[model samples]
Target: MRTAIVGSVLLVAGAVAAVTGILPLSDLVELWDRVWPILLFVLAITVVTELAAAAGLFTVIAQHTARWGRGRAWTLWLLVALLATVSTIFLSLDTTAVLLTPVVVVLARHSGLDPLPFALTTVWLANTGSLLLPVSNLTNLLAQHAMGQPSPFEFAALMAAPAVVAIVVPLAVIFVLYRRSLLARYRTGEGVAVDDPVLFRWSAGVVAALVPLLVSGLPVWIPAVAAALVLGAVFLVRRRGVLRVGLLPWQLIVLASGLFLFIEALHAVGLGTVLAAVSGEGESPLALLRLAVTGMVGANAIDNLPAYLALEPSAESPLRLAALLIGVNAGPLITPWASLATLLWHQRLTSMGVEIRWGRYMLLGVVVAPLTVVLSTLALAAFA
Candidate 1:
């Protein structure tokens, strides 16, 4: 497969680079200074959040809504999406997906609705809403910290228009596609009982974990430490039973952090400068459109986080960063590997016996991705 060939080529290239001393141990050491702490923090938060989520906290909330009426299916979907969005505000996308995927799968099976729409909506909302906080997305956080810019809240205010478009348009599409199924599931009786004790304990843990983010000017370590303490307490109380609760997917966290460092490597190696030269300095509509298209294409080929990080060093203005993020996020809707969130959706759907082919997903992506990027870019330019 093409993926295999590309992976092989990258491996060989990396080996050669290391042997030739093109990327020296010294260079790697310097890169670690810039990357390792962020990677560790992201991984830690991801693990703790996943543990809390798997404790059946959100599932319990979904079950309560399912008891209300059939319409609660949509409400349940919205709640998952909202939590996913909120989670991305403090945790990375990998963390959000790992934390929410299991809960979404169980809720969909219980409600008799396909999990695809719910999972996809959650992923999309996570990408959009995370743009609200500096710590929301790794790429955003890196850019802000690197540039010594203000907090993410300030950037979020500037990006409000695109954020609204990103959240609203896809939701409309999801509702239209699944309206009948949603209605049918709502009419069916509520499926199962939930464990109240586990739910309350997890809810308390989530609150305690989030306390650090609520107070401004707190060190990022505060939330990281709180999450660890809360999860440790929960595990102690649950004892051996805690192992039954899912842990975060450490592989995804590793992949995300590795890609972030790799892209930062690319930037250090002057790829961004080369890209800037090729892009030229212009603010014309055609130039902006070209940049957006290029961003989307790069994202599909490599992953949004890496694409954003690689582009960060070359971006000449805030508008460029905004455009790149919008386009990169939009393009990932097309491919399974494009975004970990989409991959998470696919995994959840598979677990529930729903298989969506790449071709079918592409059908949706072809229609929505371009429109979303174009609209998002225009909104960013107009507002920023």
Candidate 2:
């Protein structure tokens, strides 16, 4: 409800800007051309994941992951990390934060392990691991369009170096910080119950197939829409009660839409020049570092999405763009509002009676986020 109200306010502000000539109608058309497909992909993918959750797909995976741990706490944490990484890489960070967090938290509790490490892994990996693919983050999708709609393989290749680094750094930090708890053993939990066996199998199959299709380079939305439609039909036939208007992710769509318009308006009014002045120029290591640091600061100060949009004009080349992505994607670990995924992860944890100390989270992030961003940006430069 708070998110919906925020979205409504932003949407109204964007509409007012357009009406008052703060944002030209001509640019509005161009923005729509670029963003409509991205919005559609978000809508479709959200529906797909929501229905899949309703069918118990992620719960089954968490159960299997816990069983695979065989009573070793470290192994279980690693498995959860792997699960969060894969979920973020394929399903988007929001999905990992929103859907996978609760499942893993419960998995850890059921197995008699502290849930903090597992919870931290999901939120951190959701941001860091999201550097891998276009479908992995909304920022990646925007960057894909900016980079001429590169094939998924091509995009992955460009990001491969930093993606590995972004994932490894926080993981290293988490391991060191939580070694005491992580190294301890836990009991193996029983299998999770599924209310409907047939629905679970079908949803699992659909998601399994959807993963490859997402990276098939078929304009993204096509595969996502098809998956959503299939899942919607399945739910309608098997359990119509789960199919509702709430599945559409209207709040997110509105928020993103307003962000697009407002950011574009800011750019039109010379936000680009100001950002470029601060971000500097060239692809030298120092120059890239400046832009990346600028993005990191902006992301932590505001939110990553707007920060990325505000600084994008300064990222004139592929390397600089990569640097900016490193900052905004891997560097948003410090604040609750730095990324929506972080907030969503917190909400899930709070709902599940998992308490997280924000002060501790911020302190750890202060150490981790910069280290990850700097190391990852250097990796990007080296790859370039």
Against the true structure, whose TM-score is highest?
A: 2
- Give the residue spans of candidate 2 off by over 4 A: 133-135, 141-158, 244-248, 343-363
Structure candidate 1, residue pairs in collision: 70-186
Candidate 2 lDDT by residue in tens digits, 270-378: 8878988999999998898898889998888767888888888788777788889989999999987688788667766875689999999999999999999999989
Candidate 1 structure quality by residue, lDDT tens digits, 22-97? 6667766766676566555555555564455456665665565556544566777677667776666666565566
Error of 2 at 154 (Å): 6.1
Whole-model lDDT for model 1 versus the true structure?
0.63
Off by over 4 Å in 1: 1-16, 24-27, 67-92, 146-148, 151-153, 183-203, 206-208, 211-233, 236-248, 257-270, 343-359
- Model 1 Cα displacement at 187 (Å)? 4.5
